[model samples]
Target: MAAAQDPSLFLGFDFSTQQLKVVAMDESLSVVHQSNVHFDSDLPEFRTRGGVHVHADRLTVTSPVLMWVKALDMLLDKMKEAGFDFSRVKALSGSGQQHGSVFWTRGASETLKNLQPDQSLETLLQDSFSVPASPVWMDSSSRKQCDALQEAAGGALRLAHITGSTAYERFTGNQIAKVRATRPEEFQKTERISLVSSFAASLFLGGYAAIDYSDGSGMNLLDIRSRSWSQICLEAVSPQLDLLLGDPKPSSSILGPVSSYFVQRYGFSESCRVVAFTGDNPASLAGMRLQQGDIAVSSYCLPPNSREVKAVESDTVFLWIADPRPALQGHVFCNPVSEQAFMALLCFKNGSLTRERVRDQCAGASWEPFSAALRDTPLGNGGNIGFYFDSQEITPPAVGVHLFDPQDVQVCSFSPQVEVRSLVEGQFLSRRLHAERLGYSIIPGTRVLATGGASSNNEILQVLSDVFNAPVFTLDVSNSACLGSAYRALHGLSAESGASFFDVVKNAPEPQLVAAPHPEAKEVYDQMLQRYARLEERVLQKSRP
Candidate 1:
């Protein structure tokens, strides 16, 4: 007798800044297979350090767009090698690094729709991008564009109230303005401008994909209140902006069937559907199965929006829009799974990379040394608080490293072990400070869902737990963004049936509690956090030009 048909699978792709990761899941939401392509290590020919090319100003950062295209080709090959049955993947979605813009050349749509199965995607679409390099979220060289847009839109607060954020340099609106100002001819040749998330979806959908509402929130061009493009903000950024941005849709909307390119190259079924992709942070929120009252802190990833569609006792749907001030400090975007809900998001530029820097300096670039240092140092590092920012930070917006004594006196000296402990404490402390500003409180019953490269470190979680004074939990699966996208695919496909995303994944694995706040350390960190506030204000003033 013929073997029973294999369980249908869903695929999720996270096109992050430094890597491209894919996770496959069966109908039960259990991970079946996973793989990733590290830009620096896997595609060395791109000559990217941490997936970006940093220019002389130390502020201009861009990545080769073709690098992503080629990485996609290689990643699928890896998945095929791992015996992942592409034909079994019924639907797929993805998560991408927010605010990174991708420009398509004239006739790029024709190139995508007519891709040859016999040839590699990288080879077929080598000239598909009008702009060879894409300005990623790390670049902060758009001060001029930011100023002009803010001035045009009235001011920073006005823009923030409209777009859920001020005119951030790394945001797509400023990046687009800079391109129009600097390369007007190239802008004329550009057919479409897509965020990395939709750009990835386009690869599968066989044409340009519409931006999703949640990821669109990061563009500084979308009117968050109306969930549409702000014409004034668009005109402020560039001419004919609406033509360049085709449309924006909800994250759970199904785009179309997978492209023939996949069917020909990797044995994918033409029936495999492509769902809308969104920003990484939103994906994580969905992947973690976050309910109301839960907060997710991520490394190098942003936070969520603050709206929720509550089903009350009377069975009425309550559509709540949070006050936007908290978004000034971080970000708020629509929920990926449920169109009616939103979540709060906060990301640190000095996340894993900064810790890696400290680890290299003190512990020879190994976790063992890093863990030992945290273990040996006293709780709260004897009240020695440190703020480490290897790069410009997003929340509270400051740069530079500073150490303070228990009395809050600035100091430049500390033991390596003490330095190690200080860095870990500083990272989480800053998160707690900004999260509060965004109206997220750490109550006694609150749980911190920690995910990312650094979340596996027990010592780091200990500090995270102590600083937030909340229980820190890690998931059975680490790549929440990928899994979230996979879950989105399922949710999107079933959305018309009135099935809830939470109900769909309710039976999935539970998070394992890894760290709890030390009873004595909580009081110490509480005091240090107050001192951290004062010190950060001083640093911000010092950072001002």
Candidate 2:
């Protein structure tokens, strides 16, 4: 598609774990302006490590709501300082870090609507939240609630069948349940609850933004089949959640126009639409221009235009992942493209940071040496596998570093080069293993799309290709969530007109195939996966309290 008829701009924002990022694209789907706000370094007063406060319990992690608010304040000001024309932005959409919850104080909606153009968001809305710090996706302290939900729903598989996922501690429903149980006072004061995505949208919309179905599915509250809240699950957590959560909109629905605060304060056009924001994972799926079966207009799903084909093959293009443990679309999450097909997702806790730790120790904290080490080290590290996690891992719920030799005998460690290779291989191995368990596999033409800090490393991605035994592709940018949000912004305009998402984004640049699996990759990884699984099982057994 050529730049839209009017040559207007679509703005996409990503309220992520550590920062707030924005990308502006013209109708040509070309990025025209981009910027970001780093939480810890830029907003130092938050005093957050990696933008989160890890409670003494370690498993309970939260981020300051005011910090996120302030970051946005700074981000837009930076954009305005650069003389970007906000008035030309016809529509805007965004993706947020998945599952983080923001609590709105009673009457916050009215406070949002009547905001003063002169005041900063952080200043006027300082007391808008019931909880100053919101529970983030990193939290695992909601196990009690998870168990209760699963038991109440009958079992893990049943819950998974209903909600597209088993009860996960980081899920919003469990987090809300935890708050309701332990902090009844806070729960009582909360009038509206928003996921990080919708909350960010609420800031722009000047009212509560309805949670979109794509992100809503991650909460363990929305029914994957009906695309609405499960009454049983909601009642399990708290009473009358519908009033608090509002009705979730489609990922492509235009929520409303940007708030008066922006129009008067920062020169936004009154007519600029704010499309429904969604989870980062689904946004990335859209950004990657994924089609169904192979790729999807939404996460793991095909758009209505392409659904009849049953299976599709993509160009095997690339995207990036910046987070250490990115929540990737895989394994039957709700696909925003069509209700008939579900999206797939996989998340890992100890990704980039864990590898960076090993890189620091072995390769002088430099990627050049790190890449050389991976290249120099023999494949499979000579049958030496290592599991290195700085903190608790979500996948198998394991912690600490465990090393093993070819004989399955536990080892203390490896040389620097071997250690680097082990860490990279282990991460990708786990991704493939978990993906297969979800009934997805590496077909002949499987192509992985990702963008992130770690995705920049060709050596790391080579292992990803080898382990998955498929080719890996790459995009120019490192943040797929941001690009995907930008893509969704454009798609939302045609949504009411009934255009499939693929039609809107298909003309965007294609992914570059950075690496293909070596001839022996499939055979090598096949045997290695079983051993890694067994070792992981051993670690999980030991991790049990």
Candidate 3:
């Protein structure tokens, strides 16, 4: 039996795009030992750049499914090497990069359950994958399938109303449709489809793991209002979709004990329970402990707008009725902790990367110069606004830079100071505009939780605060997803021990107040936002077919 106090530890894993990170926390929720296996640096055998194989088409992005399995094998062995005892761990859970998938062969489950204690997992399951390469979220080659599925469901608006977002090529539903159309035989041989989150969960469960409700929302298959798979969407995508995609369960549902593979191989206690893993965003939500009105503004690899929303109570177990109102452009996912609430997220393809591009061009590629530029220049750049899209953007769906002056006339030339301020102000202004359109408000007492690596920059956080006109706070810990998963492990196990999720993690270090909005800066940004709207309209008009 696991100890109740000092020795009790919970293990949480976060399998992200570039690396697989694990954190071990004690009963008090303090991190004990943390480690990671970076895919590009650690697994040189895969020969992958940034953990993915980007095709020449630039629209097709994939990763080796076996690379992830191999990563798990190495991660555990590395943990054992660090003198950590697996026996002290009471429970385990994980978070994965949302929407990526993995396919298993016919005998893969048996292979997983019946692993040899003497040998490693990679050697045992080398041939376990039926589809060697899995399409990830960066993939956008399924435009043809997205259009067809949208048409099959009546239209884009109707489809968004049903699935919580308009049909996007990156969604798993469209990717699966592309596979069925091009490679029918591979789809036939496939027995099950698992999201990246559940695939990591299955490794510990010793069989096929069911997708969790929170992660399933990204696949564009779950009925946002009903919280179940939509039959119309299933038929619209492919036949027997239900069979291929197993039933999804709540994110906190604990599966069985640790797999015999781990118990025998790594000396993991047989009593260690495996909590259902979820997507990184939902894990972050749980980690941040966001309430009904709070917003999680992440500046991670991608900028994702995560807002917690309340759902109406229903008598039926599953409501198949579609939401009659027009749906927001972002995704709606079930809250991992609270079943009664859900989260809506909007991801912008051009995030910090776009800002970094402008910084490199205008500020000599150093953040010190960029920070100085922000501090020296006045807010709104004297009514000079710019839109910088170094890559394809989601909200406006346009690329290339456009700059304007106070009189709404185009400006082709500007100094580095003007360029630097415009980039920062423009990015946040666009976010504020889209956020309000999706029902988020910047009223008094509204707290914006800023996270991710870029959040540490005071210049960036200051802009976030001034534009949103709310106090911006940053967490002490950097990896919110892993920390959240660690909390989930404890939260699931505490059910029998009588401590709720909040009861256990309430004392975990509080977020520091990093930046507060300035009334003077707020006034300038409000006027600049109006100019941004008009400039965006003129640019979109010029780009129209």
* Candidate closest to the true structure, highest lDDT: 1
Better of 2 and 3 by lDDT: 2
Model 2 regions more than 4 Å off: 1-6, 40-49, 54-60, 116-119, 293-332, 336-340, 349-392, 398-427, 450-460, 519-545
For model 1, residues 358-394, the per-residue Cα lDDT tens digits are 9999999999999999989887888898888766766
Q: What CA root-mean-square deviation does each model show from the true structure?
A: 7.8, 8.4, 6.8
Q: Pick the candidate with the highest TM-score.
A: 3
lDDT (CA) per prediction: 0.82, 0.81, 0.79
In candidate 1, residue 120 scores what lDDT?
87
What RMSD value applies to candidate 1?
7.8
Which parts of model 1 have CA positions greater than 4 angstroms off?
A: 1-3, 40-49, 55-59, 81-83, 298-324, 349-394, 398-427, 443-445, 452-463, 466-469, 517-539, 542-545
Score residue 11 of candidate 2 by CA lDDT: 92
Candidate 2 C-alpha error for residue 525, in Å: 4.1
| Candidate order (lDDT) | 1, 2, 3
How well does candidate 1 match the true structure in TM-score terms?
Answer: 0.81
User: After superposition, which runs of candidate 3 have C-alpha atoms over 4 Å from their true positions?
Assistant: 1-5, 55-58, 300-329, 353-381, 413-418, 495-500, 520-531
